[model samples]
Structures are given as structure tokens and as C-alpha cells.
Target: MFAPTINSLVRYYHTFKFSHLDAAIVFFSFFQNMNF
Candidate 1:
């Protein structure tokens, strides 16, 4: 039980981080496109 909870927390954290990174990448791409 303890191990499963820990794994879930780690998965949640990783997904959250990935989403933020993805958003930043999208925003950066938009700015670059606008400048061009």
C-alpha cells in the first residue's frame, strides 16, 4: 500500500512537470512565429 501511494505521487508530479514544460514550449513557439 505504501509503495503504491509513493508511485502514484511520483507519477502525478512527473505529469504535472511535463505539462508545464509543454506549455512553455508552445508559448515560445508562438512568440517566435509572431516575430518572423
Candidate 2:
């Protein structure tokens, strides 16, 4: 009965995880550029 809700939650979690990683990478690179 709760399968659909669980599936959507997992999907959202993965998407958020990836986007967060991408944002981190971008911020890191920008910071490095500023340091130079």
C-alpha cells in the first residue's frame, strides 16, 4: 500500500543528492579560481 509513496520519495532523494553534489563541485571550482 505504501509502495508508491516510498518509490517517489526515493526518486526525489536521488535527484536531490545529485544536484547537491553538482552544486558543491561548482562552488569548489569557483572558490579555487578566486584564490588564484
> Which stretches of model 1 miss by more than 4 angstroms?
1-18
lDDT computed for candidate 1: 0.64
Q: Write the per-residue lDDT of candidate 1 for residues 1-36, one digit (tens) a residue.
A: 657755764576577765777766755765577689
Query: How many backbone collisions does model 2 have?
Result: 0
For model 2, name the residue pairs that clash: none
Give the Å error, residue 35, model 2.
Answer: 0.4
RMSD over all Cα atoms, model 1: 13.1
Measured against the true structure, the TM-scores of the candidates, in listed sequence, are 0.49, 0.49
Look at candidate 1 and tell me the lDDT of residue 20.
72
Note the residue pairs that clash in candidate 1. none
